[model samples]
Target: MISKQYRLDELAKQVQGEPVGQSDLKLKRLASLENASSDDIAFVNADKFLDLARSSKAGALIVTEQLRAQLQDVHQNFIVVANPYLAFAILTHTFERKHEQRGIESSAYIHPSAMISDSAYIGHFVCIGENCVVGDDTVILSHTKVDDGVEIGKQCFIDSHVTLTGECTLADRVRIHANTVIGGEGFGFAPYQGKWNRIAQLGSVRIGNDVRIGSNCSVDRGALDDTVIEDGVIIDNLVQIAHNVKVGANTAMAAKCGVAGSTVIGKNCVFAGAVGVVGHINIADNVTVTGMSMVTKSISEAGSYSSGTPMLETAQWKRAAIRFKQLADVPLTQFAKKLDHIQAQIESLESTFKLRK
Candidate 1:
């Protein structure tokens, strides 16, 4: 938690922005427009929020070129960039909390066969199992468990209470948040006679570089092969990625999303919050599934997709539900014939009215 300070010109260069009006202003932190102080920097990405940004007491503001014109009267120092939000994102990393501790704690348990890097930080009560490989500058925080044969790469930040089991292989710069369970057994079972027999999860999880998995998530081990999470995949909290699933590069799954086993989701796809995908489906690249949808089959196109009816009033929804079920009772041919008859009768009445006119 070291204090960080940056000048306006330096941050602007990092974000590829043009610093205007007092380019030498010092910014101590990044904050929201409503909460920023004279030593902080705020950002406004949209015109609707420009009014709020204009009233902010921040020492500097990150604004897009489109918004910079209307903010001419604002007294704060300005950093004009192509995308204000992107500039803010770049600036946030410069001001974020840093991890400075670089040594193993006294209470940690390391197996004799484990090979831990000299520069890695093993926090309080952490356990490293047999033959585990911990790379350089990796931080295995307090109470985390690294099981046998686990291979963790350099500069990874594994938060407290997380479990890495089943000989999972994680690449560099991976950040798994607190309480997440990696390499857990998937929901695999075989129906035998009148009972369910448990199927063995014989595989592990292979995660690529720059992946960020949020807290409370379960990425299950495969039934036979590895569950692969490609590079730059970001998963939010409470999400479930089942066994043998291949999440392609740069894919993002928001909170509460679930992808069933054996699903091959292509690169750069986005699964919004509360979305559910069925097993054994192939989702094409660049597909965006909206919130609260259930993907039952394969998606072959690349576009934004949605399913499920919008919310309605309780009584209205009940009536719609009843009518929806009643459709199963009606024959399609009979309905079409009745509809055609009604259309013919309406056309005859319109012709008669036109003759009278």
Candidate 2:
């Protein structure tokens, strides 16, 4: 990890922010408003944090024009940007600890048939099986297993304990966190005569460039074709992406999101925490599924979608649950039909009253 310090004006130029205080103030780190000290810089992205920003003892602050106006009375240094949150994000890379690539360890095992670039870093006890190719500047951390025929691209980071098997391929700049199982067997079985039979997973996983998958996620190998995770997709921890699933580019899935087999999710989609997408469905681009929603069918249009009921009081929820069960006996179609008939009767009564008058 590299330690860096930046001047207030220097950091402002990194994010195109306007520094309104002492430009020479040295900032060593970025911290939250509550935790920032005299040398650290903090950010105020929303109104909720304005109070804390006012009282923050930090050397400087990152703020939007609106927030800067609100904090004009406060005695604080300001680095005004168009979007404080975005500025904070850009500045994070400046202060974030980055791994330095070193040569492969002697304890690491690389088969004679494997081709590992000299620039690539293979950590202690890591294993690269036969016919594997690791590209330039790729870092495979300790205890990771790259099975036969697996190919990792340039500048990739495969964290500790990850399993890249079944001839998987990863593009450049991919980051797979610790304990993720890529190209593991898909959950495919046949219901034979009073018995279950396992089906061979003949396909692997193909990850695109700049994809980041979190720890403990299981991206199962396909039964026939490769499971595809497109470019710039970011998946959070504990998510399950089943066999033959194609996650589109720049799509984001939060923690515990599950997509069953053969589901094709569209690009620029957002699946909130715990969202469950069923099998064999296609979700359109720019779609957003809210938290805890269950997607059981295809979405042909781009829009925000949600399912299941929002939380209510226990008593209210119990009554609503009863009403939910009653829908089976009196479906919505029946209710619509009954309402149409009642509307016709009302019109007839109105006409008869006009004739009498």
Candidate 3:
């Protein structure tokens, strides 16, 4: 819960929403409708939760137009907006715990050649490499490694145990969660006399502004050109982006999705959990891939794509599998010959009937 309280009217102004009922009512914190109290604010975005919202004890509510109309007979304090969930998300920051950073810790190691801003916080046991640059108000948490020539921008948050390899750049407001390795070596090899020779990765990673990368993710460096993640891309935990892959703006990839090397994913694309895309393919803009789908080829148009069969009973599936296996054994030439014989017999019978008539 937040220590500070605000009137319903003040919150309405903050969210640019229309206020109804008692605008002077006080709200302390943000909560779900089912868990809200008299001092809390709750939001209603869908019809399934309307009953829960109606019975909630919240002093103030953020609601959509449909929900606002449904509660017109009731005298509950509410703020109506186009997107109640977005307003609720904005309000969450008011109750979130603020981390107060103390400038560079004594236990941190900083190279004399590195340029660090005065407003930046360098946590204990952190290592900053030579010629590396840390921007203003940026926080490098404990045990994080900043390799040589890495450039991190202002207002960025690098969580604990992150490894930023040499020459990689992060723009402002980029948030990287713990244990994520950026600019790691790409998986490239050349076959030489039945043995594989590793190709050295020479390029780095370039991440744009407002990108959020979740924990334990690995983004590989390119073999020649840099791997680029555009602005406003959100990647969930355990996602793997291969070398030289380009992810377009505002694309959101869920956990465990893997994109093979040199693939170009378009803008506003959504990849659900466990979706796998093959290498060197191009996916068009506004595409949404459902969970556990395998993309073996390029998607040229903007649409929702899915693959793989749905679940079925073992007995039913076995029967279907037998028929599928037998389909290859059918002979087209013999079947056509049998059909021709039946047609000849029918023609002979028709001629005899016509003569008798």
Against the unseen true structure, what C-alpha lDDT does each candidate score? Answer: 0.94, 0.94, 0.92
Candidate 2, poorest ten consecutive residues by summed lDDT: 1-10
Candidate 2 overall lDDT versus native: 0.94
Tens digit per residue, CA lDDT, model 2, 22-138: 889889999989999888999998999989989988888999988988987884578999898899999998998877867889999999999999899999999999999999999
What are the RMSD figures for all models against the true structure?
2.5, 2.0, 4.1
Q: Per-prediction count of colliding residue pairs?
A: 0, 0, 0
Looking at model 3, which ten-residue stretch has the lowest summed lDDT?
Answer: 93-102
Better of 1 and 3 by lDDT: 1
Candidate 1 deviation (Cα RMSD): 2.5
What's the TM for model 3?
A: 0.88
Tens digits of per-residue lDDT for model 3, 88-185? 88888777766578599999999999999999999999999999999999989999999999999999999999999948999999999999999999
Error of 2 at 280 (Å): 1.2
Score candidate 1 by TM-score against the native. 0.93
- Deviation in Å, model 1, residue 70 alpha carbon: 1.9
